[model samples]
Every structure is written in structure tokens, then in C-alpha cells.
Target: MTSHRKSLARVLAVGLAILSTGLLVAAQPGWAAPAIPAAQPVAVSAELTTADADAWLDGVLPALLEREEIPGAAVSIVRDGRVLTRRGFGLADTGISGNQPRPVDPERTIFRVGSVSKTVVATAVMQLVQRGQVDLDRPVTDYVNIELPTRFRTPITLRHLLTHTAGFEEVYANMILPAGTPVPALRETVTAAPPDQIYEPGTTPAYSNYSYALAAYVVESVTGREAAEYLQDEVLRAAGMATASFAQPLPERLNADLAQVYPSRHQQPIPFELVGPWPPGSLSASAADMAAFLLAQLNTGGSALLNQQTLALMHSPALGEDRLGGLAAGHRMALGLFEEDRNGRRILGHSGDLIHSHAALQLYPDDATGIFIAVNGSGARADSATVLRRAVLDGFADRYFPAAGPGPSPVGTAADHAQAVAGIYGLSRTPQSTFMRAYSMLASVQISADDAGTLTIPLLTDAGGTPVRLAEVEPWVWQDSEGHHRVAVRVDEAGAVGAIGVSPALVLLPKPAWQVMAAPVVAGSLGVLLFALLAWPVRAIIGWRLKAPLDLPRRDMRLRRITLTAAAVIAVGVTLWAGAVMQMSGGFSAQPGLIRGAQAATALGALGLVPAVWRAMRASRQAHKSRAVLATLVALAFLGFGAVALAGGLLLPDITY
Candidate 1:
């Protein structure tokens, strides 16, 4: 791995360990959505005895809380319409010693539920569909006033948005808006930065917050009500989730019980996260509140939210193979639910993360059981939360609903298939057309093969980055050592591996050597730029030390010094300018003044090298020896850096989005 790859891996790990708060977890291995076919969600008759289920959670939840240093967490188990064990384990508001603290009340204390709001919002859309007021297959423009910009001729429909096949590129603008910012209406926020459709409608799957915002926009326009209002009356309230509110900041009545976000175990709590598009990820609710929705899901519409038929359709698979980037074999996309195949049994659920808060809601309809986990704090080691959550859920499934039999005979771990899948893989969620896509290098996703013939995917490793050897279970399907997760590879027509689906939420594909190698070039070239900036003064000191003056014409020496200084200044100034832009909110969407200055400086830096190149050439021909050679290197290095900056859009003329 190169320096850039290491740096990017750290960035990706922290980013994923956290999924931009543990969302789409472009960073951590366990955080990704592995492939599971969508076709198998069923309503088989199954049940869980409350005593065993409650005993298991009682033994596990606190142990995880203690081991992981998670400040507060709530777990709810709903068995056949009965709240089995919905309780809190730690403090909800661990206020600073000088500040007032509130212990968690799982039944009443509300936590920011993250993207689980998508599921809730989807239910609202299905409710409208049930009423004949909203058609899932109808084009969105038919319901909303705005038009989605698309390269494809197919129109985006409500059904496409529901299944996440609306094809809108991911948009993060004000998605997690900064504190103290006024919350914008859902429609205003979606229209503010409408993402272009990167694929034809229903042709691909990309996890997007914007898609749901548009779906909510359609819901609002059709009903003449905002999303929060509609969800409050139609979904949250009807499902008996009284403690749940889709509003960004909780309503005044519920604000007092709202939980604060903690980025680290010991760091002072951060301010309330204000999301502009509340529909996508802004719901704040208690574990008990979330259970009501789960109950509805497991029972297939016990609430007035939607009819049983619409609810079943909402839970049914929307896309099968996920044409763009294949999802895990047994996982599939439904209206809002992610139907997961695990342990020879099926589970439906969704996970949410906004950095400081993490949540997972799972429903096992066959067993008539569902589980919800919400953690109130996060840190660099946030993968602990994911592991803990999955452990409890998988443990419940195993203990309560054990696999009927053993899996297929395991092929040797070090099979030819393992060697074939080996190599560097990059996250598929990367920005393809934008320079922001350059950050994909930071992901540093890789799969290495051991002599055991087993493949080790580092991302799937434990918190310590120790990889797990995976055995090929079937063609293109690899199972983890623990059998808890699996990877499905997609091959092109030539039968070459094109991409690997870890889950419906993420896909990994081979990264070209040039891209992996670009990091070293960037690092080495940047170092040269710094040296060029220092050369003139250093050379002057050398001359003073020897008590000698320059032998070259004053004009040539002056030109060399001046041009080198310009190149150095341009390079350093642009770097500082970009650093400043990165500090500001929404810098990715719009460049700040420093960034513009850097762009201008990079251009000036490129031109500054011309005189230095001429001086070096003149000196070289005259046998100036070392001076000419060094000058030539400086000029070339400056030009290389400038070209890279320009091409990569690191500097101003290309700054506008």
C-alpha cells in the first residue's frame, strides 16, 4: 500500500467505522451491506418464547455496553406483537459534571434514529399508494413541481425512489446540516441541489438520501402537507410510536427528552445534528417507539399506516440482481426494507448512522419477531457498535430460530477462486465525475490471498484490522470464516470478475494500478514543490558561506530566483487555500475564497516554471553542471505538480460545481 492508500484507508476506515456517521460505511468492513437476494421474504409461521429471548438480551446487551464503552444504548425485542424486552442499559444524557445529566428512559427518551427515517417515510408513501392518492409507478414530476435532470430517457417514478433505483447520484448537501442552521422545508432542500440521474430509472442501485427526499416531496405535493406533518399523522402516530417524530429537531414538546450526540466516549457531547432533509434521516425516537413500527412490519400492517396488501408489497423485493452493481446473492431491494438471508433463515431490516448515533432495525416476519438497537455515542472504534448489534441479532436468530442444517461442503479456503478474487478493490459509492471522487483513494479497500488458498478482505477484518480468511462457498460467493457474512462477485461477459457485492449498500471493484500508484506521485511531487520554494534562499546562503558572488549574469540568476519563488509560492499558497476550504461547511459543493485563490495560484505557478526551465536549459548548455541540472529538475517538478493540480481540479478556474 502507498502513503496515499494508507491515508485514504484511514480516512475510509474512520469514515466507514463512523458510515459518514456509519452510514454507507465506505470505511469499515463489517459496516457494508453484503449481497443478499431480495426475492425470498416470506411469512412463515414461527414464534419465540419470551423467557429465552429476554434472558439472552439481558446477558448480552450490558456486556457489549461495558466492553465497547458505549455510553447509552437501548434494545427492543418484539415477539409476536408483544414487547418482549424493551429497555435502556446506560445513561441517555451523560451531561458534563458541571451540567445536568439525565439517565436514559428507554420508553420515553428519544434518540436520532438516522436513516431509519427512510423506512418510515417509505411506509408513508405506501400509505398514500393504498389511498389511491399516490401511484408508486407514476413519474415523480407528475406529483412534484420539479424535474429530475437525467441522461437517460426513462422518467424517475415513485416506485424507483422507493426501491432506491431512482438513479440519483448521492447528494450530501445539508443532509447533516450544521447546528444553528435553520431547517429548510423538504421540497426546498431537494430542489436546492437536484442531483443528476447517473443511471436510467430502475437500472441500478445507489444508496441515496436525495432519492427519499424526492419521494417525500412527492408525498407532500400530493397531500398538500409537509413530510413531517404527514408522517406524524399517518405513520408515526398511527403506528403508536408516540415518542417518534420525523421532524429534524424534535418538536418543542419532545425536545426535552431528545438525546444528545456524542462523537467520542469521553468527548463533550456535540450539539444537536440538524438535518435539512428530515425525511431521509432526521427521525428522533425511542427504542420503544421504533418497536411499534417493527410490530407493524412483522404483522404486515397491524396499524392503520397501510393495508396488509400494500404492506406486503412494500416488504417485497423490488429489484432482483441489482443490474448496476450486484448485491449479495440472498439479499434484495424492497420498497423500504432490505431483505437479508442469513443462517439459512431470512431477515428484513435497515441500519442507520449519522456519526454520533447508530441504529439497526430488524424484522423476522416468519418468526413474528423483530429487534431494534440504538446507541447514543460513537468513536473511531464505532465498529464495535455494529459488531455488537449484529451479534445480538444473529445470536437471537441462532438461539431462537436455529439453522435447520449445515451449509454446503466448504471448499478448501485456499482455492483457485480465492486467488482469482485477490487484488485491490475500491468502493462503488465513489463520486465518478467529480474531483471529490479523488477521495476514493482514501478508501484503500483491498483483498489479499494467503498461502492457505483463502482470501482475506481487510475491510471485513476486526477492529484491529486483522483479516478473516474466507472460503469460497459457491461460484462467486464467498463466506466469512464465521459464516456471519458473505461476498458475491459479479463477472463481466468475459467471465472476468468485475465487482463484488458485500451487501445491497456497497460494491467493491478492482482499482487500476495507476490510481493506487497516483498517491506516491502526489506525495513525492508535493515534496519537490516544497524544496523548490526553499532553493533560492538556500543557494544564497551557500554563496555567502563560500564568500563568493554568482558567476552567472545577474539577469539569469535573478530570473532563476524569481521564477522558483513564484512556483513555490503558488504551490504552497494553493495548498493553504484548499486547507481553509475543507474547514468550512458545504465546501465540497462550493469552493471558498482560499480555494479560488489556490486555483489562480496553481495557474500562476504553472507559468512561473517557464522562465526557470529556460534558465536551466541555458545553464546546462553552458556547462553550469549541478546548478543547471538542479534547476531543470525544479522546473519539471513544478510543472508536474501544477499539471496534476489542474487536471485533478485541485486549484480555481475549475472550482465551480
Candidate 2:
């Protein structure tokens, strides 16, 4: 696949791996009364019992697994602080050579529950808060001995860290390393290349693994114990998650029981993955063990893990309601979880992705129920994991907790409001000052509007992979037809759409027309340059075969050579950069030297613009207007390409992404 397509696939995988609706919003001016009648949601009847859950899961999961070509999955369901059922489906490890396939075991097979580790780490920090060893409002710098290169004046606190509002740029460097790669100290790993902080603390939510790593470092600083050690003692042990561990290169006893992960069902198992930000997303545990952790969070089992009052504080909305505006109607950030309300019930959950293994954990606190599902394979399609994850969550909710749904109908001004907000949005979780900024462009989301005030975002989809269609229900607030997901927007003082909130932990900021068109401009310019340069070889062969000596002035000949050489260099540089990005297993940390070399080559090519411009002017003075136009076209194409590179920070010395 082309580098552009590959980068986009990776973005979609991560975006969907987390929940689809994950952004932020602020209040703006209110609008008028209803235009369209609201549609009511459908309700179904099903009791929450072990037998019912098993029957429901059997009817739903097996069909999904077979259709999606997923190898295996493990699930745990809990109610009233007790495990209702633990089930394993499909194979843990497909046959290798002549060996027999191993069936997944809910009690024995361990799966890496990626970012769910963030919830556990947040719990540890809260425990420290209860003991007076840590304060949620204190600046993180007070505990970790590292100063952040922040863009805003507000100090980053543990609350900001837990809620993903610290504003650190999204980074993927060293996120996953080879199994035997030596792990670094939390301090060193986090401090090595700190992401630039682009938003004020507590003002915007930008999902960040780096922020969680910093929070974990604070835990280490206060306790003088490795984060894993502290979590093992205070969190895991207390929750009765005996099989869980944050250790990379899992202990021999547990490693044997680890289910092999796969890119797809028909593919061979991938090698063991070592997570870099261990505290944020590196916990391996069985389905039964995960159930115990969920029960503790529900305040049923593992009550010693956290006190009731403290736990309540942790789960309550951490962001101020007034600051949230229309966003209050949508998702909101709690200390360690996303307040993803569904079917009128207040739900909190987090999704995790380890590339091969995808997991979703949801808590229906009011109903005293929680469900955990983790699959060993991401199906063949790019969005297979996303489809499966949403299906299980939505299916389970609809079966047992269905509710009548219909919010306020579409406002009279919905059409105009949708038009104003429809545009390409840049994710706040992107590198703002690095060459990786170029890659971030591929992750932009486009929101479209219809005359009826409905909106469509291709990135956010339902369980069936159809883009979730939305209608403006109120001023600055849009929700799915069934009210499963709510999206909110913020308008600037100038009355332009400023930001969008789809998830509690994420925000999408507006991208102006120029920024949105930059990639295509650069790509089109490359095509022009390549087309013009081809004339050089074509003319040489044509003239040689015809035996016609077509002579040109010495100055014109020199200019032609110079322009063609520049085009050649630009093409080679871009090709090299694309190859490097496609081959990178990690992020920018891979192939740094080669990427820098390409940057240098492009820099040298940009210098050709001066002579090309001079040549165009000189040619225009002569009798041949056609030659002048040709020269001018080449010069303009080169200029366009160079301009995008400079504007994107592609030629900048910084390579950290």
C-alpha cells in the first residue's frame, strides 16, 4: 500500500480501538425551536442472569466471530459486584505445523488489556490521594523531577493527567518494542523526548499516553517503588487480579498461558509485544481476573482497593460542567474513565488496543453491571476490530438495558448550524512542531452536512461499519438517531466552528482551507514536476533517433538542466521519505537518519527555484512565448512543493513525533 493509505489505516485502527465518539466541546450562542420530529428508540426485554448472558452471548458472538474471521475472544460479565459468567470462544492458538490448536480458557488464557492499564494506574494515584501522599490538584512537576516545555501557563496536575487534558501531542515512538528489548526506567522513557504541550491544562481533552506515563512517574517518585511493584501490592492484589502483571516479557509461569495474538485469523501469531508506556497500557490478565477488577471498581468486590467516597470522587465528572457547555450533554471525562452514556443510563468505560488484541470494558454503574471483552485477532478488514467491539457493547446494552430514546428534535436553525460547522477538523492529539506533522494530516476528520441538518463523519461508524449519521438536536449538539452517541461543537467569538467534541478524552479543532488542501497541493505539484522532467529523457531519445540537431542557447540549456536536476532530487527525496515511513515499525524513532537525509536532499532541491525563475523571465523577453510558459510552469510547481514542506514543518530539525 502507498504510505498515505498505510498511515490512514493506522490512524483508523487506533481511533476505533478507542471508542468512536471521543472529543470535547464548549458552550456557544443558543438557537431556535424544533424543525423535525424526533424518532423514538426501540426497547428489548432480557433479564441480567448468568444463563441469559451466556445465551445472548452465544447467539451474538459466535456468529460475529465466524463472519469477521476472528480467531478467538474471552469475555467476562459482572453484576452486583459478582461475576455472572466468564466465557471463552474460538481458539487461543491455531495449530502450528502439526500441533493441535489450543482453545481459549477464560480462567487460564491471558490477553494484554492495552490502555485499560490506564484505569488501574489512575486507581493507584487515587489511592495515594486518599493516603495524603499525593494531591490531585498539585502540579505534576512537584512529584516528577522533570520540567515540561509547555505552551500554556497553567500547571499540569494529576487531575489533568488522569483526565487526558494535559495537552501533550500524540506520540507513537517506542510504544511497542520487541519482546527482548531492554526496558527503560519510567523517568528516562518519559523524559527522553517529551511531547510539546499545546493546550492549557484542564481546558481541552487530548487523549495522551505520554500524560499517563508522567502520572505513573509521579507514583514512583512518591512511593520510591517501581510502578509495577506498587500496583501489584495496592491495586492488583487488592482487586484479586492475581493473574495480572505489568511486567514486560511476562514471567515464565504466566507467559506459557498467554494467548498468541494475530493480525487476522488465517495469519500466523505475531511475536510478543513489549509496551513502552507500561503504566498506561501494559497489563496481561485472564478474563476472570479482569472481572474481579471490574467488580472492585463497581464497589462490590475488592472494596479495600478504594474507599467508597474516594471511588465516587474518582468516577464523578472531573471537568467543570460550566466549562463543558453543550459538551455536558455528551461525553465527559471522569478521573480515569470516559462517561460514555448509553440507553439513558450513566455508563463509564475505556477501550484498549495492542494492535493484535482489542478489548473494551464498560461499566453500567447505576445498573451495577460491567462487561469486558477481548479478542485475540483484528479481522482481515481495517475496521473489523472496531465493528466487533461496537457490536458487542451495543448488543449487550440493547439486550438487557434498552431504554426509550429521543432527545430534543432538530432545531429550526439546524441546517444553517450544520453548514457552519461542516469542515475538515484536525485532531488536537497530533504533533504540532515536528516532521511527524505531515503524517498527522492523514488523520484529519471531515464532517459533512445535508440540507435537512443531518451530519456525517466517515470515521465514526456503527457496529455494521456504516458511518453513524447524526442530526442537530439542539444548539451546538448533535446525536445519533438512536441517541447512542452525542457530538457537540463550540463556536468562536467570530461565529466560526472552533472545536468538536465526540469523546470525553479527545477534541477536534478546525483546520482552515489552506491547511486542509496542503497535502493535495504538494502531491499535485510532484506529479507536475515528474511529468515535466520526463520530457528530458524523451527529447534526448527522440533527437538521437531522428538525427536532427536541435540547438538551444547556452544560457537556456543551462537553466533547463538545473530545473530538471532539481525535479529529480525532489522526486528521489520524497520517494525515500515515503519508503522510510512505510517501513517504520515504531514511529519517528525508526529510520531517523534516513528521514533526515531526505530532508537535506529536499532542502538542496529547493535552491533550484532561483535559477528557474530567472530562466522564465529571460525566456519571456525572447521571441518564444511557449518556452517562457513552460519554464514558468516548472518553477511554479517546484515552488508549490517547497512551500508545503516548509509550512508542514517537514524540513525542520525536529523528528520526534
What C-alpha lDDT values do all the predictions have? Answer: 0.66, 0.77
Error of 2 at 302 (Å): 6.6
Give residue 610's error in model 2 in angstroms.
2.4
User: Model 2: what TM-score?
Assistant: 0.92
Predicted structure 2: lDDT: 0.77
Name the top lDDT candidate. 2
- Per-residue alpha-carbon lDDT of candidate 2 for residues 1-657, written as tens digits (9 for 90 to 100): 011112324753442221111211111233111122234543557888999999988998888888888889999999997899999999888875344799999999999888888899999999999899998888888898888889887889998999888878867677777667887888887889898888878877788888888888899999999888999888998889989998887899898789988888888887776777777878888998899988998886447688877877777777663455455555777888887776766678888877677787898876788999988888888667667878898888878877665666778888999998888988776777777676555446789999998999775667675789888877888888776778878776677876788778776788877887876677677777888888888888888999864466898888889988988888777766765565453332456788788798789887778888888888889888888898888888888878877876779987766
Assess the local accuracy of residue 132 in candidate 2 as a C-alpha lDDT between 0 and 100.
96
What is candidate 1's lDDT per residue for 1-657, written digit by digit as tens? Answer: 011112222433332221111112111233234433223342223346567666777888788877777778888888767788788877777776455777778798888877888898888888888889987777888887786678887788887887677776544344456667778877777777677676677755556677888888888889998777888888888888988887656679998887766765566887777766667778888988988888877764365576666766776666545444444353556788676556656577887776567787888765677889888876446366666666777777667665544445456543676777788877654444443443554345778776655677766654344676666776667766445567777776666777776555545668887666645555565566577667667867888999875688887878777787676667655555445334423212233565566556667777777887788778788766888877777777766655555544454343323
In every candidate, how many clashes are there? Answer: 33, 9
The Cα error of candidate 1 at residue 174, in Å, is 2.0
lDDT of 2 at 617: 85
- The prediction achieving the highest TM-score against the true structure is 2
